[model samples]
Target: MDKIQNQVRPVFPFTAIVGQEEMKLALILNVIDPKIGGVMIMGDRGTGKSTTIRAIADLLPEIEVVADDLFNSHISDYDLMSDFVKNQLENNANLTTSLIKVPMVDLPLGATEDRLCGTIDIEKALNEGVKSFDPGLLAKANRGILYVDEVNLLDDHLVDILLDSAASGWNTVEREGISIRHPSRFVLVGSGNPEEGELRPQLLDRFGMHAEIRTVRDASLRVQIVEQRTKFDQDPNSCIKEFCEQQNLLKQTIINAQSLLKSITIDYSLKVKISQICGILNVDGLRGDIVTNRAAKAFAAYQNKKEVDVDDVKEVITLCLRHRLRKDPLDTIDSGTKVSQVVDDILS
Candidate 1:
């Protein structure tokens, strides 16, 4: 068993987070539409970046997965399973599912490729003449969250591997005398303080949305945050209980949005505006349009609307465009500001 699997603790409630509304919204959008990719959080240390990301785990509703499958493969993913597994699933009308926590995997900076992508079980191969695989962090994170703290400082090779796996939604480990491929889909959340170092442009481009946060400067707000933290530490069970009702409501909201997302629609005019805004900003590719479209649909669903609106577009513009904007020598404004300006020009 993985060490992380062994070390379990209660996560703080998402409702307990004091501020950073944008961060919270962005995370919810991703849950509604994983196709928006994942969010990159660049901020000051002790700003609750990690805490907010971790709290997301508990708010998520439990997933129904294969009872005996370590990969947590959903029943609908039978086509992606191995031949034997597919046959087993097909033959068994008695297929069982167990509700498990939505996995929240922490990818430490010093992790190795084999550790990320699993390794062949050498003991089984040598002693029993049977080939077996030991799953890794990426496998554990399948269909869930893969969170990297201090992502900017991660090794280049590891970053590249992460980028590839994140892009393809699958991982293949061919070394250690065994080859294995599995569904490794996950929402890739990364956070780092910009003062430490800048993220590689390649990896930066891989993220679907970007949010920059700072420590709360308001005296009263800071005091509120401290009190919340103190309460959580003193009696976590009570603290979690206090927020349980809200968490349950939020969880149901997310679940409803997931099912409603497919039915949400946008008019051609709004779609054109999405394209034009990205064009005016000179974003590198169609990724901006796709992310914006998906985000808007998610926002609409979250709001219990069947069709997207201009407000939906406005709500997610900064997050979708900030990281994808191209730099110009003459433009000195912040990326978020630039996005806001273009959105205002087009949608106003």
Candidate 2:
């Protein structure tokens, strides 16, 4: 069993996850529309945050790419390729193409700036007296998920790099007298325990949705959590098999949702509703309103609806605006609750 475990590691299915519905929903929303921005899953330790992310990685479909491309550059992005590749394509060279699983690149706590944004390959330079842009984690994560555990502990410099890349949808690195740029668009997913530290306000605002999770409280529910975890550990294949139907259903739902989002109607009143809620909450800037609008549409699409409704707008207010709320010393109410209250006043 130990050897078997070592050879084929198994992940707990996303559908089998017992609780944290909001966390799961937040992640799913991103899948439907990555432009809704990334997700920040913050909570106490051992809350299965990372496990949920891994399960999502398992559920996502593979993507087509140019074979042997370090950046996983799509054919549509051929213009961004190096001069060599541009010339080859111009000459009708035989460039291989293939399908690969959507990458889930982990950004470790100790990752350096070079590791994140990339630098010239040091090993090749020393061994062969050659220089090449060894694409970094950001490059690998392009058009995929970028999972950052302990995101609060990320170095300040790396945070800046991520912010810049995420904002511009590209990363340019200059090293060894060579400059290279590539598409670095990705859905950023981060999880961290608040006991360690709070993330910077700037970075927090960057996440499209913020979900604060807690341990299962009800005794029976807690028991199920433990039981399912044990069963999964002992027989992951069997556990996953049991959930296969629901898993496949959810996978298809998201794929359909992606198509549905493009056609989902965004009414003018819906825009007013979003603006009113944001205005009532005193949320800074326009990000809260924008994220809420996108999230609401994504939610409608997820539910197989063709148009955005008031209820749909109501459902996502807290997740979209919670982290954007300015600190209020006088008001003791929860920020999530505040968003709910303001939403009621404006939309009701």
Candidate 3:
């Protein structure tokens, strides 16, 4: 019974996911360049938000991490290593390394600050005279992905904490004057159903991109999606087998994009136009411009391009800038449409 309970269930393949291209693209872009911040997805319920996010774990290539490290610290990159691991390296201590799947941490709505940010073991610290820290979701998510579902319903305080850590690329925990800081760099993906509620604009703008999806309007496409899901439910292994090729191909594309992202440059003129759109929209800060630039480059890298083009910018501009616009309750036009209009006007 214990063995059965421990068996891992099969995950639905990312390649098998139907439609939701914008959402998929946003996720891929974030994977290619995590520094693009993370993606915020808002749409109707049952649109495969959670499934799509979970599938990303299957798609990501394995990474080399310090063996036995709680933070999944990178073997060589100091930026990706925890303070504990860095200290060992500085001391010239022998370190073992292991390759593990890129972690995908699901942040539950009911989780407390201690659970998300980790806690210092006060009893152990006082008795042992050494800092004993227990890592949390943020630590486990280092060099990986952190997903928050129904983010709008989450407590605003928690959301703020997450945003602060994500932006700073580190999580700090302090208890009884003992503080522990570690690398918490991870792609922060969030999804929510808009009908339930909306995230505050200030909080929402922190996300690098926003993908708004809707229920499939096409009857045939809906039927196809239903059939695919039914097939997977009936025979999970076989369904996974069917899309194995596409999944491998996508994984390779993502890996290639990650390596190529640094070299993929956007033109100076394109940069000016992107900022112009932000300026016209009255975007609060330079985040819009920075995200748009990074997202465009990431998109180009995903397409295996050497340089960014107008088409690449066009493909991602809406996703990058849509959530940054201020809400106009009096205006009936949606934010996506407003961004599109500006893109067309400026790019035309």
Query: What's the true lDDT of residue 298 in model 1?
Result: 95
- Per-residue lDDT over 1-348 for candidate 1, one digit per residue giving the tens place of the 0 to 100 score: 333542357678999999999999999999888878899999988999989998997689878787777677787775335333566767875668788888999998889888888888777777998768888998898879999999999998888888788778888877556567887878889899999987866678888889889888999999999999999988887998899999999999999999999999999999999999999998887888998999999999999999999999999988988988765678779889999988999999
Candidate 3 overall lDDT versus native: 0.91
Clashing pairs in model 3, backbone N/Cα/C closer than 3 A: none
How far residue 172's Cα lies from its native spot in candidate 1, in Å, is 1.3
TM-score result, candidate 2 = 0.92
- Arranged by lDDT, best first: 3, 1, 2
Error of 2 at 204 (Å): 1.0
Alpha-carbon local distance difference test for all models: 0.86, 0.86, 0.91
RMSD of each: 3.0, 3.1, 2.0
Kindly list the per-residue Cα lDDT of model 2 for residues 17-118, writing each as its tens digit: 999998999999988888888899999889899999989988887787887878776765763354446666889988887887778899998888888988
The regions of model 1 sitting more than 4 angstroms off are 1-8, 79-84, 90-94, 121-131, 176-178, 328-331
Give candidate 2's whole-model lDDT.
0.86
Clashes of each: 0, 0, 0
For 14-97, candidate 3 gives per-residue lDDT tens digits of 999999999999999999999999999999988999999889876888888999999999878988888889889999999999
User: TM-scores for all candidates?
Assistant: 0.92, 0.92, 0.97
